[model samples]
Target: MVIFGGAGDLARRKLFPALYSLHRNQLIDQRFSVLGVGRSERSADEYREIVRDSINRYARVDVEDEEEWSSFVEKFDFVSLDVKTPAGYQRLREAVEERERRYTIPGNRLFYLAVAPELFGPVAARLKEGGLTESDGWKRLLIEKPFGRDYPSAEDLQAQIAGSFKEEEIYRIDHYLGKEMVQNIEVIRFANTLFENMWNNRYISNVQITASETVGVEDRASYYDRAGALRDMVQNHILQILMMVAMEPPSRLKPEAIHDEKVKVLRSLRRWRGDDVKRYMVRGQYTGGYLQEKEVPAYRDEENVPADSDNETFVAGKLYIDNFRWSGVPFYIRTGKRMEEKATEVVIQFKDVPKNLYFNKTNDLGPNLLVIKINPEEGLSLQINAKKPGTDNEVVPIVMDFCNNCQEESPEAYESLIHDALEGDRTFFTRWDEVSLAWKFVDPIRQAWDQEGADTLTFYEAGSNGPKEADALLIQDGFRWHSPYNPRTGSVVHGSPIGD
Candidate 1:
């Protein structure tokens, strides 16, 4: 494994720790080795010490075995060489070749790029130019998020990497797909007899996908100020999850088949323009607001953010499908930073009763909802109608929930994903076609936002739900935001939760 920017925070905080977990599980052995590459002038032993400290700090150590830790450290060595220059590529090639001979391993290589987005192309060019990716064994490339600042740049990046490896050789990591709950979306829909048939327009009314964060962008201001919620979360994680939820049942469980169906759903999305942009979507930038008991600064007040920055911290939009399965059903998506609560979930709202015998009476009874919890507390809950506690014929709402992770400790998102990468399973990874199609669907909205300007980019206070425009988008369509202000109780869930 060649990590281009091994000295970076992503490597130390996420990659190395994930590798440690894989080592702990004994999934990777001496047959595998990690080559940490950077331009820094650090000796191999010095880099190993840095890795040791990082693993100890970041990894969730169950055994805490000194011997095991040492063994893991021994498998990792650093190479200080520039990825852009020819001489630098020579050093990397020699180091990898020497390692392969020492371990008597085939030339299979997993080039992991944990570097800045701008460096991705140069690194790919150098790797291909140096013939490091040429071998009988498989050559794979794992790219980090921020695929591109926008659509055109993303296409260029793809063109850059595809020059080195085929589309199959590339794995686009969403991290969300690696989550135990996210993967369970397919299982919950397909494996169960109750949901598969009703998972369409007939029984379902709406779907909501919400990914909210309580903390502000502390140090990520530089990146956050540029990408915001749409590209950072929606284009990849939200869209992928939505595809899994809304895609038709695949003929087979192959990754390609799954990806094909996802592409279909993305293509089916109803295009929004003119009044629809104001009615179907909303954007907001958070001003100075209070977080918990302490007052948190606004985006402008953040260290790297400009005072007049137009970057958005919140986004909410409503999307529709033009196909038979989801023609009338609307899918609402909202994501933001510095919200009242930190939660990620999807809600699926079922159609209202055909006959209202009680004549719109108010009580604990409510619409039947299937809520899929994606994070914080991960699980599945079904809201069903039952006989009221005392009343004879009156019905009330009760929950039949199956919390998958509550029974067993949930695995970390990266833990499961990294395992799949090592095991050569791309089931949870994104394919190029799906990525390109998703970009196609989202590219228009991004272009419109940039060209039309922020006349529509409203501002909201920090720790608020979102701009009123978001609420108006839904309220005008007979819906509202699901703001869980208090974590202790369940709120009325109208917006689709899991598949919503």
Candidate 2:
């Protein structure tokens, strides 16, 4: 493995920790090793110590055995070089060759580009020029997110990288696809008779996919201000989750088959333009407020952000898949920073019964929901109507829940993705067409926002759910966002009852 940004925060916080956990679990072979490439000046021994510190601090499993720790870190080597210049590629190549010889390992290469998006093309080009891409074994390239600012840029990046790697050899990593519950979506649909029969517009009412964060842009103002919520979250992570939830079952459980189904979902999305953009999308920025009783700055007040910036911190929108299976079903997606709780969940709200047998006594009954919890907690909860234990006819919503990670911790997203890349499995990675289609669907919204500026942008309190217009986006359709889970009560507080 060759990590491009060896000394950066992503390397320290995620990459090293994931690699250490993989090593600790004995998932990788003994011949496996890492060659970290960066511009930071550090010897191999010094880099090893840095990795040791990162593993001790951030790894899921602790370092309990001194001998094992020593053996694992010994295989790591570092080379300091300017990634932009071709002169440093020779040194990097030499270091890689020397490590393969020392470990008596085959020349399989996995180059991880963890640097800025601007460097992705330059680094790949340099590697090709230096003859480091050719090897005795298979080679792969793992690219980090924000593939491009938009469709054109992403297309250009693909063209540039095509010089060094083929489409089959490239892995576009989206961590959300590796989540436990997200992966379970396929199983819950295909493996279960109950769900598979009703996973369509006939039995399902609406699907809400949310990826919210209780955080403001802390140190990423430069990036966040430019990317905003739409480009940052919606274009990649949220859309990927939507694909998993709504895709048709593949003919076979192969990477190509899965990709084919997912791309169809993207292709079926209804294109929004002109007045539809305003009617279907709601964008907002956050203002100063208390979060968990502690005061926090607004998006504009954050460091490096312009005072009058129109970049959206929150976005809520309705999407339609103009296909037979999901013709009239609405897929609502919303994501933002510094709002409410930190959760990534998909709520599959099933249609109400044809006859209201219990409505006369109970006034209203909650919609049956199959909620898939993805982050902060991994679980599944099904909400159903039941009579109160002591009452004859009083009906209430009750939950049957299954917690996925209550017993033991699940593997981190990076861990699963890295392992798959090493084993040459592209099951969870996004293909080029998927990325391009997502950008095509998202580009019009961005262009509209740029044209209208702050006229279309709204503001919400930092700790609040989001702009009222967001709720109105659904209320206008006679639907509402599902009430979030209440930690103290261990139940989902019911929102407005679904209208007939």
Candidate 3:
């Protein structure tokens, strides 16, 4: 494994720690080696210390044992590279060869780009031009998101990498897909006959997938300013989740077959144009307010952000697929930062029953709900009408919960993704087709925002759900977002099953 930008925040914060966890779990063998490449002027021993400190601090598992520390650090090494020059690539090649020979490792190589997005294409091109990619064993490239700023840029980046490696050699990482619960979407659907039959427009009313965060852009002001919520969240992570929830079941569980089904979902996405774009998509920026009971500044007030910046910290949209199974069904997605508790979840609202047998209930008997919680807490729950605790036989909503992460700690997203990459599993990685189609769906909305300007860029309190317009987007359709905050309680609300 050769990690570019080894001393960067992502490398120190996520990559190294995940690698350490993988080692601790014995998922990786001693014959494997990792080479950290960066411009930092540090010796191999010094770099090893850096890695040791990182693992000690950020590793998911305890790695304080002297023997274990020594054994793990022995396979760790570093190389200093300017990244732009041929000399840097040559030096990287030497370090990789030396480490492979030392550990009797195979020619197999995994290149991870944990550097800035701008460096992704150049680094991959340099590796190929430097002959580092022409190994006797398989060579794979695992890249981080922000694949491009927009559709054109994403296509260009794809073309640049295509020159060096084939489509199969690239692994596009969306860490959300690696979440234990997210991966279980397939298992929960296909493995169960009940869900398989109801997983369509007939039984399901609407699907909502939200990934909200409580922290504003602190250090990523430069990137976030340009990317905003659309490119940053909706384009990759949120859309991928949508596909997982709405895609057709694969004939088999193989990677290619699964990808094909997912691509079909993307292709079937209903495209909006002209006035419909503004009607369906909404954006917002956070205002100074409290979060976690502490005060914080607004998005515009954040350092390095322009006072009048129109970049959206919040995004909510109504997405539809024109496929036979999902036709007329709406997929509502909302994601933002500094608005609410950190939660990632998928809520499937089943259509209401034909007739009501009970009367005088505390609240309206709502549609059945299947909630798949993805983070902060990991679980699955189904809400159904049940007999109230009285003899009158009134109906009330009750929940049956399956807490997936309650008994044991699930592996971090990076841990699972890294392991899959090493095992050469494309089932968990996004292909180029998915990427291009997602960009296709997102580009027009971005262009519309650009051309029409930010006159509609609304504001919401930092600690609240989002701008009121986000809620209006749902109300306009005669439906509402299933509150992901506390689905177990009576706070969950349902609206008309057939949307306006």
Highest TM-score scorer: 2
Ranking by TM-score: 2, 3, 1
How much is the lDDT of residue 288 in candidate 1? 86
TM-score of 2: 0.98
lDDT of 1 at 201: 90
User: What lDDT score goes with residue 116 in model 1?
Assistant: 87
Task: Give the clash count for each candidate.
Answer: 9, 0, 0
As a whole number from 0 to 100, the lDDT of residue 459 in candidate 3 is 90
RMSD (CA, angstroms), candidate 3: 2.1
How should the candidates be ordered by lDDT, best one leading? Answer: 2, 3, 1
Per-model TM-score versus the true fold: 0.94, 0.98, 0.96
Better candidate by lDDT, 2 or 3: 2
Which segments of model 3 are wrong by more than 4 Å?
A: 359-363, 485-500
Question: Pairs clashing in candidate 1?
Answer: 207-500, 208-500, 346-497, 346-498, 347-496, 347-497, 347-498, 348-496, 348-497
Q: Give the TM-score of candidate 1.
A: 0.94
Supply candidate 2's per-residue lDDT for 43.
86
The lDDT per prediction is 0.80, 0.90, 0.87
